[model samples]
Target: MECERKYRSRALYKACMRAFDTLPVCALVDSRFLCMHGGLSPNIRIISDIEKLDRFVETPDSGPLCDLLWSDPSENFDDIDDQQPEFKPNNVRGCAHFFSYYACRDFLLRNNLVSIIRGHEVQKNGVRFFRKSSRTKFPVLISLFSAPNYCDTYNNIAAILKIDDHQQLSVVNIEAHAHPFVLPNFENGFQFGERFVLYHVTNLLLSIFNMYSPEELAAEDGRHDKTGVELLNKKRLIGTMDRAYAELKKINKITLNLRGLTPSYSAYKELLTRPEIKALVNEAEKGRITSFDQAIQLDHIFERRPHT
Candidate 1:
């Protein structure tokens, strides 16, 4: 009733049908970091199940959830609930069960997986992460999107996590995309369809460009002193996605000297590389994610953000 009035679409029937059909299965993924629409196109890989739901927020039969969103997440997380209203909703609304993560946190203390990571909310200025429990300090939030021009408001983006050879969970909330092959200063940010296409276009092109033999790579330089110019350009394009890849491959990295998250590297890799990741990102980009998938979605938002 409200959405139709606000957006003036009589397609509620069509929309509702779409939501019920898809969301139930998309919330079960395990990811260290997530973004609304960052994962799309062919080159970018997005993890689907780790509860990356940007579209499922409820109407509350009220105004937007009164819970607070951080303005300077890193600097002000302790004040999360400070500015929040008396009424707030638990913003998590995807397939990844908040209760399940609660279960996993305690389980990791005895089992293998250590921390759970998720990202898909407003962390004003782009970054704003939190650790679930100090008792265990296991489940954590790691996100990045600092300096995103894509957003009209000043947005700060960030990311989390890294792994060593021993397969331990090390979370890192970075300020920007991890660009190894591009320039330090460049413009980029959140985009849906066509922008996503360019992202993958640039990514695949770079991958293929890097695949060329040393002589072939030198051929480009032979024509112009682009070695310096080209490397920076590549990083500008591959920057964020590069970071996403590094942290994602820990479970299955065989030659990279990186830690293995799960003993079964092949399975881990297969899960990580699934096309569903991009699908999930696309879902978020379109605001199609919803809680209809859940028997009961997480619906409680504490008035105050914690300080632990």
Candidate 2:
């Protein structure tokens, strides 16, 4: 009612939708880092395979599209073995195979790439790096989560990685603010345990953003604020989607452990059916918005000049 009255044809809404039509699922930076939300898939042999995909359409139920949008890094020891294939069914989220160290190495070597920088997991420290192996000389996979104090409970800091023309990397951690209202109007509906699980699940699925730390990243390059913050916004859309998928994997683990609270697979299945969850997935598919409140908070965080 309000939308139609505010704009007879919903011009603002339509304009935003069209803006989303131009986005790609992933991007390559200086041909060094494979920047994607989720981890690699068995079906995706080459990066160009992504370009071959038809864009601006509803993501199909299964295929490289679903895997790219939904997969996560495999933590299972059996799957991470270098001698064995790094691909295994991801029982956690129930879609997209879990990728191991060997799998990531193959992808990078085949694609002639360096690191796979993905933002799909909530690290207690804001950012996490998974090396090729305990014996590897350098890190090959970087998992970045830019939401500080995740869900107003995790107390986690948020960070962003900056790679300059020279291919140097730096992570800037944002201090989590005190947000009393985590999910507005949504928490009051469920029971205690249900709400507890739901909040964490929602937190896992929603990826709030952070202000960039050019100074933090500039220690190596000495290039200060030359690249305006506008460039950072471009990465936020894809990064947030990646983080949301990673968080979903976390929710699955949490529910599995708290089986008394949630009915394992049934609990996750129920979660998928949630109207709130559905709206989130839809927006992620559209790549439009993450969270209205968090969006405003991010604007405020960046708008204020950072204190030196």
Candidate 3:
């Protein structure tokens, strides 16, 4: 019976990974295994402890960024078109990881799961879809962007998606448009001067950063010269992964600083380990969470009972 059970367990593990790898964008996202950029809100009382910070920066198996960049497409680079070219921007304005990581956001939108949310990227012109993976390719995008003048000051706006009582989806894809201002050539209320102005300023800064001498802005093989990034070998890359995991599992329950520390738990651990009773607690805590919810989860951490 033991040998047979082992055989079945091994086979089941392989099947789960295979299913996970090929799961459709819809299904992968719909699984409610989620990730995002921004830290959870009620944005008051920011955590200051170093141990707690690790919970914020988890791996794909444990971190938020991995959900965006889990599938390498082919190689492990989730980088977007690196530099800002007019009308074309990198996958993310600041970080390229979102090409794969944003997949989680896409998943959230299509399924209408409210618990998963991210904050780093701005929502200029609202949540625009990438051509390569739109709703047509991956039809649910929770949305992206969070600030004004993001990605070279192109779209300056905020967004909100409303699901009414009737179950109808109302998408606030953009802020209020100019009613009095209209122009056919500009394609909207925005004029030529304001649109390209930010783009030009970015280019000018890049030119200064790259220029070796007068009469030449550094261009590599007719492309913008990439800023230097410290190259890492395969070993270094793998080591970072190990470090992320180790930091996450470090025990803290009996520590002296429990009183001084802001009480919180790891989303990454709960998601990966599937800890007993967490599924119910995590589900219940979904949608905007509060400190009360945090206290409830804290109660479930390694309960040791009385034997008296």
Candidate 4:
């Protein structure tokens, strides 16, 4: 509600909500394929069973409705045998069940359906086909993801499923097109203004501090001698400040490069674990690697070398 008030009109928000209210949770196409946002529910054995669900209210935390919205196809479908149960608790998601190949096969056979089409998981090629068995003529389940370059980081292809009158399925793949870059986290005008003010204020204070000469600083310290130990100490302090400023600039550049290359904090930490990256970090700490470009070149050299 806060986000809607900030960026969208109340009327538009209401219209969108009304449209969602009318949309069906699942669809049967050509009386052969079942299409839904997520996979099947353990409680729903037939198509009529889904039709009888009370979907008008908010989806409950657990039950047939929640499972229909949140359940996923099991990753170990190939390993599942005929004797194993069709559905198991989804440990990864912690709410719904994981439907295996056997479950999907049983559902299709029970409903007199050819295939189940769902869109709960992202696919690298935008589509995935799961066969019921090694000798099955057609895939029992088809997972289609129409978002290319998902989250602007996965570099995945988008695809659409085309079902002809004969019930034959074909996939059309699409590559991500170039688009204008935007800052992450949907930064608002107020946030940008705050950052601008803080940056300038910090720079202004640093400039004022740097304006003081060594002699002036020593004088301010109540040391009147021009060539005394106080003057030497002040000189050393100035040199230390210069070194610190240089190091800060280098760190800022590296941080920008890392942000551009790594999409998330987990990925950044994983990159740090690489031997080349670790070596670069050690050099950076010792003030040896001064630029991100130098670090990139060293990383490339490590990439080209064969592993022992």
Candidate 5:
């Protein structure tokens, strides 16, 4: 029975992967709008370029297929003074490259596409429209993330894009509904009740013992001189733990904000070398920067620098 179950699971996994392999990497809507999971790839100049990729195999680490599925639109593309390139390394994703607005525009112009629709990032709103320039009638790119209240923490609305026969596009936003809370790891009610009772009883006994213990009384009398310092240190430790917990929550938030945004431990160490990010960390340590959103902004860190 066990061997049969294992074989069935493997077969199911392969079947799912095969289904994924059959899907197109991109689509053209009415010969106007190009749709993909991620933004443009530098290697793909025309629609036929995407068609040439072998979709039957597993996705590669780096290539046109990888870029089409992993790339993102550069945040600094609109900065005229920066003169950013059409494509640059995507440090956030650790693979593929961030495509600039100009790159997307050129691709759309070359392919006779009016706009590009993609979904790889979470937006506060369900949809985000890229900046429009004089050369295009519509926003160059539209990002639509359909997962509502993403991962149950983002509290972000979800949306779906609708296209009618006339090729008119409309977005429908959705709010998340409340669901029953389940204990972590699906712990059962009886086990939870037992643990709760044991915890309170143990704490109560410990408190009573501390109140009456002969050793504790002796220490309280003898340690009067160090009491103030010890209390101050305890307060400091508590403050430190609270700050650490808050920062931990923020880290979780940032890591889940979008796909491929999570930095490795090595990346964090490397970022500390930058003076700007270092200053922000210092401010956070001093409590000047209370919110993670304000303290850590990745856009400036990952901004494209012009070639010297």
Candidate 6:
């Protein structure tokens, strides 16, 4: 049973990876601005260069795809006024080069791009604008990072960039909301699935129900409960499956963060050896129980139990 579960998990991971192939490497807006997740690469000299690359496979470690996903801007290299091409190795990140202003300018001119907007590194102010040089008037590059109070450590402000009809750029900073000091156990797969995953599962159910006409749904009212959602019509179920797939396509990535230190490999390995966790996972899977509602009811029952 364990082996079967592991095999299924591996298959699901592969399917998720293949889905990434359909995502665009970069998006051009209004034929003037280029938007991407990371900075420029030496191989990607022109905008057309990105169009030529195959995005069907996983990003290579030392190629254009890797550079686009991993690169960061270097403040140290921007001190000089000379427009000579330069490259700075980012020993901190251990991947992708730290690009210079001259490099940004060359890429912009070559591609006829007005600005390059990217998000890779976090900023305290949530946004940073980089010009071609200290004397330059217009911004050649913009960096944005919107998750404030990142990792529950930094007291940073998040910002949103908005462009008006006249092409004027503006930013709105958002204050971070207070969260519990002892955050939810995001590391626990079972608990995480119960909290976040099940919410989406319920949405999938409702999105399925959204397909049927009110008249059709009302016809089964006598058979269904007062909520009128008990009866599972085959046609509606099929429509739900199609809609669920469409919803899956809309997701790009999921980022998980550990609030503090991660457990050592030996400690984590020891955790897997525990029999109770295994039993819990096995029982949960076998029952097809991914419902948060069930967990809430169990919690309420536990609360009502008399203390020893």
Candidate 4 lDDT trough over 10 residues, lowest sum: 299-308
Ordered from best to worst lDDT, the candidate numbers read 5, 4, 6, 2, 1, 3
- Per-residue alpha-carbon lDDT of model 1 for 188-290, expressed as tens digits? 2232133445555656766775776545654665754568457556655575665555444321122121111112334435433556543433343343223
lDDT of 4 by residue, 1-308 (tens): 53465566788777777778678989998888899987888899998998898887766767888788778888777664677778888765566788988888888888888888899776778999886644356788888999886545456689998878787778999998988654433435475355445555555655665687755765665766754456556556655655555544444444433322322335445656778766765564454443435544433422211221
* Positional deviation of residue 150's Cα in model 6 after best superposition, in angstroms: 1.8
Give the Å error, residue 179, model 6: 5.1
Judging by TM-score, tell me the better candidate of 1 and 2.
2
Candidate 6 wrong stretches, greater than 4 Å: 1-12, 83-85, 132-136, 179-308
- The global C-alpha lDDT for each of the candidates, from Candidate 1 onward, is 0.35, 0.60, 0.34, 0.68, 0.68, 0.61
Better of 3 and 4 by lDDT: 4
- Report the C-alpha displacement of residue 96, candidate 4, in angstroms: 1.3
Error of 1 at 254 (Å): 54
TM-score winner: 4
Instruction: Show where candidate 3 strays beyond 4 Å.
Output: 1-35, 38-119, 130-138, 149-155, 173-308
Q: Which of 4 and 5 is the better model by TM-score?
A: 4
Over 13-85, each residue of candidate 3 has an lDDT whose tens digit, in order, gives 7666666554322112333323334332111122122123332332323232332332111122223533422
Better of 3 and 5 by lDDT: 5
What ranges in model 1 sit over 4 Å off? Answer: 1-21, 24-112, 132-139, 143-151, 158-308
Q: Candidate 5's residue-wise lDDT over 1-308, tens digit each?
A: 22234454766777777999999888888777888998889999999988899988877778899889888999776565337789998877777789998898888889888889999877768899887756766888899999876545456789998889887889999998988754323435575455445545545544554454444543565674576456445445545555555554444334433223234546656767988776665554443333324423533454222220
Q: Best to worst by TM-score, what's the order? A: 4, 5, 6, 2, 1, 3
Clashing residue pairs in candidate 4 are none
RMSD of 2: 24.7
Clashing pairs in 2: none
The collision pairs in model 6 are none
Alpha carbon lDDT at 237, candidate 1: 58
Q: Write the per-residue lDDT of candidate 6 for residues 121-187, one digit (tens) a residue.
A: 5577889887653334567889988877554434567787888999877898987798655422233
